[model samples]
Target: MLDNTKRQDIKVILQQVWGYEDFRYPQAEIINCLLNKQDTLVIMPTGGGKSLCFQLPALLQPGLTIVVSPLVALMENQVQQLQQKKIAAGLIHSQQAKSDRKLIISNLTQLKLLYVAPETLLTPPIWEKLLQPDLMINNLIIDEAHCIVQWGTTFRSSYTRLGVIRDALHKHKQNKITIAAFTATADTLTQQTIIKTLRLKKQFKKFVINPYRSNLQLKVKTVWTAKGRKKATLKFIQQQHNKSGLIYVRSRKASELLAKWLREQKLNTVAYHGGIINSKRRAIEQDWLTGKLPFVICTCAFGMGIDKSDCRWILHYHTPELLPEYLQEIGRSGRDNKPAIALALISEPTGWLDNEDKQRSQFFTNQLAKQSKQAKKVFEILPSQGNILDIIKEIPDSELALGILQNLDLIQWQDIFNYQKKSSNKNINSVSTSQQTKQMQQFLQTKQCRWQYILSAFSFIKEAKDFKCSKCDRCSLEKPSRIISNK
Candidate 1:
């Protein structure tokens, strides 16, 4: 419904700013939805131009657009990109100098887009500025929207409180704020969870582009022993030679050990994880981006908002616990629309000889249960209504407990700093993570076309049916098995 003038203006901006002559599949429509002041949920693939959809509309609009992102690196990367385009974008993260953050806050009206982490968004200075009457805000965007459902109930509790943003910002009848949630991967259940948790309007525009990336070849190799697993990973990396890519491991410890071993093997790689200092992490990212380091042995911490267009491959040292995560990680490859491959190594069918995946699943499941029990205990002692700041002082892990309670609908946040307990008949279930892990395990063992299974798992069932991807290992009979045998 974008009229001629508006559409033409957007097209001009697109060419002038991003150098894109035309909008990708649903990008034009999504931008139009936001320009019309409608809430939107966009499920587009990683390289499917998700950012432009919101970024374009923000340019065409009258007021500042706020993007709530999950990682510091992501926000910084995005803000940097916008700045390179000569767009006035700013990000407020912990890494920024105090004076820099203050100046940005004071000059908010000058910015087209303000990127912030969910946790940082709730802090007093930023929150107060947002609540100010003089500020003219237009859209509040949630990037990596799946994290709300995946991590909201556990560690990133601030995401659960984001529903208040809509109500708080829209207090004025004239200052309507549109919310748009965008992510590369989300199943039907995840989509519903995002819609409900973010409290998107009933008539919010939903655009789901079937997350089928035909350019990325999907393959899984089975290893029968711990040594076989190591050998297979090394062999795969050796095959890739000097091609830029990422090797995803499950733990910081593993990242360190594997990275060291890979270096000993004369491979250009390094360890990357959240535990590393920001400067070092930034350096590693820069090296990878510039192809100085061909690959990095990393946990899930790397590659959120990075734009390495020619990344040729992705190797999973440990199988991901969830299908969505698998999708998101592999999505890092082939951003330039060229061919790429994602190879995941799993223990043989029995998991008797090599059980790293089994061990990881058990460790995470146990950790979830322990956290749930602690949260429930804290919930029992918490007053019916209390300030989160005060409760955090009196109770250990209260924030996580409150997040779990809020996620279960057992507690309603009256505001960012306060909550009201609600009666709940059912207990909090921690088995959800375990069930998700099982789904990934099933995916590894499935004989069907890997891409087809992915399409079906992500709710593109109609496309999945009779969808035999000739590119996958199953459908391509000429390619020999890559399985690393114990012998």
Candidate 2:
């Protein structure tokens, strides 16, 4: 617990830095836990003030706080926000120039906080710099902590290797370093995966507030064809005209097509996805933030670090493959404690769209299993140090294979893509991806209250049964039909 003086200091800092008079629920407690150097995990919903929990502690602590984030845009946005408050902050990522990164590293000791991508942090240059005797890193924070479970297994393997980072830093630092992981959406499986993958201390504290928002109405609509889905989405947007909203699609092409179609309907909108150039992506994000564009058709790449509170509606043109993703996307609405609506348009099984989605899930599951086996074989045969091309010749998709090896601590990267073997362990774990897909499909097809299904899916059983929110489509259907509008 914080002493009276320290508690007073915290409030003073909060008011001075953020211009807020008080801490949100659990923010003060989480910050206190970090100040006491306890390993902590926070599962707060989007726009729940998760950043301040760490940002305030980083400001109060003496040494630098290293924040491991997933996206460059997120890191840049955070650093920019801190800089606006005149806080000493910097970031290093792949998009940054070599000279700029070098400068940032050289001034590490002068910074209160530094945000970095996981892949960048694992590279030899950054890791070696962090180990330097003069630098003092007090905390290692994993923002968007769910990504460690979501992407660590398949996409970016560096996340899995984060469990060793604290140990590595401990070897050089005289004092113990604290680790804090924060995310907006995580279920039971994801929470366990984060704890195990990060290897957080046994005494680590967990702060999991219920992610449900009573102000947001949840609904799912079944469309028989692609055209029907588009028409339904357009109708929702038209009904919420002049209000800020987001339309989530699965692919870059879908984002473009939908944005174009919406524009043809006289709605001002833009397409956003990973495929777009960084400059254009930033411009679109700015336009949406400033209300120049009332809506955006985007892939999953657009949500993180965005702080728009008055976003009145979120439409899912297609259901996400996983429930956690759907929750995170829809949680973007009603952030200001005002009424908002989230609707998902899922294709009926009579059409090929739903089947294609199932097939895509199965394909990825099989592919991951096959790659895991091949990666183990390649690990057994590869030399201690060699070119990536040599490994690629022996194994297809060798890059992902090497990433898995690196994550398991069997190897270390000397540069961005070069690896040096550290161990010969062949113990590989295969992740089951089908369960999440099944759950998503179940949620889409279930006849129960939409909010209740979501609550149960995330393991809030009692709340699921006791609180129906009365605003969801199912509950609303039990009453008179009423059109959803911005309050």
Error of 1 at 5 (Å): 1.2
Q: Summarize candidate 1's per-residue lDDT along 340-443 as a digit string, tens digits.
A: 99999988876788877788888888878887888789878989999888998999898988888887788998878889998777587642576677778878
The whole-model lDDT of each prediction reads 0.86, 0.83
Q: How close is candidate 2 to the true structure, as a TM-score?
A: 0.89
Each candidate structure's count of clashing pairs: 0, 0
lDDT for each residue of candidate 2 in 347-412, tens digit (9 for 90 to 100): 677657556455555666787788678678768777888766566676666666776776566777
Q: Could you report the Cα RMSD, in angstroms, for every candidate shown?
A: 4.2, 4.3
